[model samples]
Target: MTFLLGAASALQLPAYQALVPEIVPRKSITDAAALSSVGVNLARAVGPALAGLVIARLGVPFVFAANALSFALFLIVLLAWRGYQRPDTRVEPFIDATRAGIRYILHAGVVRRVLVQLACVMVPANALWALLPLIAAGPLRLSSSGYGLLLAAVGLGSVGGAFLMPAIRTRLGIGGTVAVASVIFGATSIALVLVPSLPVALAVLIVGGVAWIGVVTTLNGTVQSFLPAWVRSRGLAVYQLVLFGSTAVGSALAGAASSLFGVLPVMVAAGALTAVSAVLLAARPFPSLTGRDRAPMPSTDVPPVTEHDPALQGDVLVLVRWQVAAGHVRAFLTSMDALGHSRRRTGAREWTLHRDRDHPDTWAEVFRVGSWQEHIDQQTVRRTGDDAGIFSAVREHASDDPDIEYLITPDRTETPHV
Candidate 1:
């Protein structure tokens, strides 16, 4: 029962996280993310102390009951929220959708880079959060209250950092801010190991908390910025999977290392790794969000098959034939290569660029989608404003506008569109 409840709770997390991008304006997405972090940190600061008090006054059963009731209240509030409406979309089979989402992230350069950087920083950074209680009890010889105070200090620092994020981002930019934060946190981790004094440790934790919030919030915003509405939930699910997976693995490893060696030695090693990762990642900074990354542009083209239900239709094939001048062939091919990445990232199952054997000037771009509905969704919601520029560039190289053809399987079974 406990495992099932936990699993159910975890399933809703991505949807809740994805809601922030949907509710807020694109321009203020970074600030909104910061605000969300602030709420989490604020809860971290308050919830524990409140829970302790409740546990002392009441019993463990009462505390658990209260927790269940709180969730019930949350459900009530969620159901009452009628402002945001989800876009109408045909749901794909779970496994196929999951594969498509994974494919899109793997193909997209910016999304891939963000996930890699997040893992690099988060793995080592998790040491402090996961092992701090053990350190407080064993090494520092602090009481439970003292440890709570230390956590409170960290939470306060996170709140401050959240409030200051916009200014820091404006001055330093996202990459610079993350790099500085990582270094600061790494240094603080080392300091926590060295410094035995409680007051000093609290100060170090405050700095560490600020740095933690900065890196996490920035990474969150970066991921949210790049994802389109169609794939936002799935993409975020993958991001959260990486995040929690890394933390779990890091914590387990850190625990083993601490047991083998000592807490201080393990912490110092983690700190060093974190600092090095920050420097290495800073060299290949995360891509900044342009105006184009804010939202996907809707395509003007109508769906090819009006007679058939898109959901029932199987594998879509799209071919575009471009007439290129002999002199522009090389340049056109170069542009097409870049465009191909965009195509694959935006739900194309298979993409290929072909040159005509008979007429060397003629070029063909072919791609496939899983279904007609998938193709429609890909055309309408998967495309970004930047894609328009790419298409325009390709058209510029062509003597005339490119000809497009859509093909589907003949044996299409009619199923009810959900």
Candidate 2:
């Protein structure tokens, strides 16, 4: 409940979403990117600890009530707000283009093993939420001091997990390493609950923490293996929601039920829940699509690319080239990830971020508007704002040269499949 209040306020704060209107009003793709960013920044600034402290120091009830009052303020302001007319960039393309990549990493198999293993491990290990603290205070007879120490061990282990993943994988083989780590975490949590002494419990928790790192690093590296450049952020966010949020809720519920009963009963219950989750995951559809399978694999043997199809054209077929600034290549393409939102405002058929893979620092954003005039207007407005950092802040920048090539060739491609 307390956590929800903080999350809501962080997202709802007027100071944050105000950035949205700026970009949306200008038919710029940069608004959603900037606005989501502002909200995130504000949360970071007011360190939630202070807010949580303030809530706790005050009456918890009042804290929640005041949060509600603040939300009312946000809604009142929003109700009065007017949005700009969305620009339309609809176009009949000479090429149908939504160029995304599906290149898999060399260690793709190992990384996949890690992703599945972590998801499986998370289903069980996370259930300690309702049970662990109770065990710490009740079974281990630890004061808050010992609990804090235990938390530190976990934090340290997570940091180590980030750095030690590759070495761990090489030593254990991906599947063996993750499986061993998962067992340790699960067994350690159970041991922590059963152990009678605070010192013993703490030792188990430190071991658990070390294993936890192995779990986290394996999962993180696995995700990086096949993420498309365009939807990278969204994909990560969705993974967090499904993998973290679902597991967290499942754990909390199990822990609460176990607390109401006995620790042994709760452990048994958690194990059963994990077994069920494992079955469900294994039964899900297509657990094995790699990047190479879904995308057009560019290879040396593929005769000098010659696709003239409009709707089926890949990204490379749209714009020939562009220049960008140094050090802004990643950021430039990242900003283009907001293309869908920008497309709505500007009525663009497509908003594209093109990057040179050979020199990752090179990139450009290509806008396809229905009418060439809207395209011209977008350029004129941004070119003027180029000096104000208005375009820089909201418009995509490039470490490579940032330029647009408006194709003048008449549409000649035959109609594709309906």
TM-scores for all candidates?
0.92, 0.45
Candidate 1 error regions (>4 Å): 301-312, 412-418
Give the C-alpha lDDT of model 2.
0.48
Tens digits of per-residue lDDT, candidate 2, 1-418, equal 7798657644344233233433343222222332333344344434354567877788578766776797789778767778643322233232322211011221134323444555666766676655666666776667776665666555555444544555666676544555667666767766665656767766776677667666554444344333332223333443454466657776777766775887766765564444343343345422342323212122221123333344433222235244556666566555454433333232345555556778655555565654444333233321121122323433446333334354543545766567
In model 2, the runs with Cα more than 4 Å from the true position are 1-116, 161-163, 268-418
Alpha-carbon shift of residue 173 in model 2 (angstroms): 2.3
| Per-residue lDDT over 91-118 for candidate 1, one digit per residue giving the tens place of the 0 to 100 score | 7799978888998898877889878888
Q: RMSDs, each prediction?
A: 3.4, 15.5
TM-score of 1: 0.92
Minimum summed lDDT over a 10-residue window in model 1 is located at: 299-308
